[model samples]
Target: MVALRVGLALGTMAGAAQAEGVLPYRDADAVARGERLYEATCATCHGRDLQGEPDWQSRDAEGYLPAPPHDQTGHTWHHPDAVLLDIVRRGTAAVVGQGYQSRMPGYAGALTEAEMREVLAYIKSTWPDRVIAIHDRINVEAGG
Candidate 1:
């Protein structure tokens, strides 16, 4: 079972590496679509500018953390593309199991896989070039 899990993990990493470059950050059409999707679906909590909530690092009275920014100021760029997609598709609670609590609800029912990709691409498009380069390196390292 352990070996199987390890194999699956490795395969996932490899797939992530391949998919990292698939985000159409440079594609104007995709980025525009992503922006629209983000505004309609994510702006309430994450902010219209992707600034997230105030004191996002701190837990609220209900013990739930606020949404983090997807811009360079946040840690969103730190994760590989595949991980980001999975989180969006599965929600934070489902992805970070073991009783992790999050207010982030999965969008699997609300968004298509391509739409999810577009949203992520929009987020990435907002980052500075340096951050984007660093994120690309992170994806490469994760693949290896």
Candidate 2:
């Protein structure tokens, strides 16, 4: 049973790695650029402190999802780095499927891949050490 669990975990890790490839950047400058871009593009709805808005988990009358918080308080970190990047580049609608609407904009034409990595880095940088460590474990398991 223990071995089975280990095998499953390793398999999951390998699959995730295969899917995500590698993170594009690891430097401070790229993270800084991402932070700037996030500030300009994402902060209004997500909040400067990453707290998100009140009732962020609840949808509005129009059926739009409330902008979720980027902090640990929300589920943002539950996603893998690759998934997050896709969401940023393609918009939440792309991931959630058509007929689903999201206020998030696709940064595909607006931001470079490196820029997307930077933004992601900036968001990760804000996380506490524990969360960061978890992310690192995820990266390691994913073959980063």
Candidate 3:
């Protein structure tokens, strides 16, 4: 089981590395661009305010959980940068396998690598300073 978990984690890391480019997410330009993309593409399900859907933790009648908020209130900050990039490029279902169903659509067809990074950067920018610091630590711990 440990080997299987490690294999899956490695697989996720490989996918994230493949999806992300050398673009710096902290760049103001990238963050700004990402904001626009988020407003246009992400706001629908995540909400314009990033509040996400109500009852996000519970599955609906169809067995699909609602989209969780991207803000500090949600678990988004718990994931490292690579995981975020992977989730955006591949969709939440790809990240959460084992028969988990996600409402998020993979943006690989619609978003460029830079765009995905930008979008995630934009989301991170919305997080509080403490959350950002924690997430940064998470990235560092992951050797990012």
Model number with the top lDDT: 1
Alpha-carbon runs more than 4 Å astray in model 1: 1-20
Using TM-score as the measure, what is the rank order of every candidate, best first? 1, 3, 2
Q: Report the Cα lDDT for residue 116, model 3.
A: 91
Per-residue C-alpha lDDT of model 3 across residues 23-115, encoded as one tens digit per residue? 355689988998899999999999888899999998999998898998899998888877888888888888888877888888999999889
Reference-based lDDT, residue 95, model 1 = 93
- What is the number of backbone collisions in each predicted candidate, taken in the order shown? 0, 2, 0
Best by TM-score: 1
lDDT values for all models: 0.91, 0.79, 0.83
Q: Candidate 2: give the clashing pairs.
A: 34-118, 34-119
Query: Model 3: which ten-residue window has the lowest total lDDT?
Result: 15-24
Off by over 4 Å in 3: 1-25
Model 2 CA deviation exceeding 4 Å by range:
1-26, 140-144
Tens-digit lDDT track of model 2 for 1-144: 999999999999877655433443356787778778889988999998888888987889988888899888987776778778889899999988968988988899989887888887788777888886677667666555
Let me know the TM-score candidate 1 reaches against the reference structure: 0.85
Better of 1 and 3 by lDDT: 1
